[model samples]
Target: MNERDILIVGGGIFGAAVAYELARHGLGERVLVLERLQPAAGATSRAAALLTMVRDDPGQIALARQTFRTMAELEQELGEDIGRRTVGALHAAPASHLAVLQARAEVAAAHGIASTWLDKAEALARAPWLAPESFDHAVFFPDECYVEPYLFATALLRAAIARGVRCEASEVKRVVVDTGRVWGVELADGRRRAASVIVNAAGAWANRLSVDLGLPLPMAPVRSQYWISEPAPIFPRDGAIVLLPAIRAYARPEVGALLFGIRERQPAVADARTLPADLAGFVFDPDDADGWANLAEGADELAPCFPALNTLGIAHYLTGPSNYTPDRQLVVGAAPMIAGLYVASGCNGSGISFAGGVGRLIGELIRGAAPFVDPQPSAPGRRGAFDPYAPDFLAACAAARAGKTSG
Candidate 1:
């Protein structure tokens, strides 16, 4: 059996970032990452990679700030550009949501993050393509940024590997536990790897792995889809990330085009356990007329801010599954009734912006050090009697994905 001090399942951004943090904190060669496929092949690759720091949730806001700072400095440390784009971000809302937007701006200011309120004319000046009256008010964070998700994740993993962390392209068949302690993991090829601690950052498949060990996690997988418009003169190459909370839609610049997504009123939930082992054959739902309809309506709402969206042709469409928790926060911390086991999953659509902080916090927890932020709200064990597979739980998750508050 191969022995490791810490074993992390999944090679998405969260797992890669954790490995980097562990190495940064002196764990070095003691860490091993087991990836079913290449890094960022899952939800991470499909993420919009928006790095907006202003959020309604304080915990998420804190995490986003930390992640942004960490990622800002990572390019220098790794000697590679993670594609950090400091194009700024604008969050706009209708009159009914003005209070919420204003409150979030205040929170951002309190955290020392610069944010300024803009009227319709000012917002139109900043983003001339916006429809003049799409939003009643808007808040712009000038220092907000984004990164290429796959590139950033791979860069982190490569940095970790350079610092002595090992990554294996192997599938974790199951986690081995005995006497209430994690032993390690059994690979699909009948090989066993021993480790004292295991971190399940398995993305959408996290709950499935937990259930296999009789420790079901409170998380569900929901489909997230986005569309990319063809290069159009109306879309600026350096446009700011524009968010319309009222419509549950967001748009950012992508290779001279506009990349956008809308949260469906009724999200499609998937059974992670039944997913095919080889994801190469997986096909996204191309006939999602309802999803497109929602996006069309969202475009109509955003047309006042971005008139070009109403006329632009969609060049491509991408879809993938993202995990969500009941309360819309990530599940990070030790698992209940399981010694030497930890989890950092259920990103709730903010994994890219939360990766650095989540990785650092999980590493600190493993090392018995103080976390930068309180982990109680996001603790995996906090959801007592929370059935992840229950209808209500799924509904709550759906609501969260749609940018609504639910528990």
Candidate 2:
């Protein structure tokens, strides 16, 4: 077996980010990334890619602020365009969330993120499509932006590879463990590679490898689906990303179309073992099997804010599994039962937004450098032993996604 310094088992945003951070710290030659599929081909490919800076947690806010700085440095070093759209974001909710929005706006200002509370007329002026009186309160962040997730993830991996980090198209079925530590990894082809450190960034299939090590991560694959409206004159090419937590929905402009996501009353959850290598073939909705049913379910709450919902042409549907923890935080840090095994899963539907931060944290932790953000809240072993593939655990994870207040 070939000895390695670090072996990351997934090529999605988390794994790619970790590799880039390690390479940035001058450990590229010793790192290797193994992907079952192409980079960003899983959940990363389907992410909404919202970069919301204002959050409930101070740790998350700090992490999010670092994301912008990290991405800016990466782009300059790699000369890659991440397709950033800086139209900003608007949070329109009922009066019930006014104080919460006000508090969050204060948090944003403290972080040097400019935000303003918009009156009804101003809200409609910015988002002419919004129903003027649908929402009682609206907060606008003028500097918020988003990116093309695939390009963002792949750019990070490409930068890492360019800096001597190696990547291969291979699937790691399980980590080779002995003496209470990870020795290496065994691939599906029965090939083994030695690694001093193994980071399980396998995303939806992360738990599959961990469960075999007698350490099932407290996370599950939950379906996150969204619909795109067909191109129309009403939908501007650069409309601001809209957040409506009152009705549990959000929308952004998708090239002259409105791309919206609705949090179903009971979001879909899946057994990680049953997931296909290609998520495109998976069916997320089990009810009427209509992804549009989610829109209908939230129509009552959404219609007031978005009257265009009734007239918009449904264009496309994107569905995939996002690793979700009950607390809706990234599962980072080393696994307690297995030494030298780091875990970074549980994106909670914000992988794109949090990729850079996760990468930096994983890299810092592995390099013995102090982390930019405190890692206590996201420790992987914080939750007790439980089968991630089990139904009750899956429900808990699904509940987290359903109850998520942030993007």
Best by lDDT: 2
* Per-residue lDDT over 323-399 for candidate 2, one digit per residue giving the tens place of the 0 to 100 score: 88988777888788778899988888888778788888888888888888889889887877766777888899899
TM-score of each: 0.93, 0.96
Off by over 4 Å in 2: 1-3
**Model 2 residue 231 lDDT score:** 82
lDDT of 2: 0.84
Clashes of each: 4, 0
- At residue 296, candidate 2 shows an lDDT of 75
For model 1, residues 1-407, the per-residue Cα lDDT tens digits are 34467999999999998999999888968999999888889889888888877776778777888787678668888777888889888887779988878787788888888988887777766566667667788888899877899998998888899889999899998889989998889999999988899999998888877876667777788777788888876667778888777777788888888887777767777667766655545543446633576576566555665677767878887777788776777899888888999998988878898999898889999999988889989888776654567777777777777764210
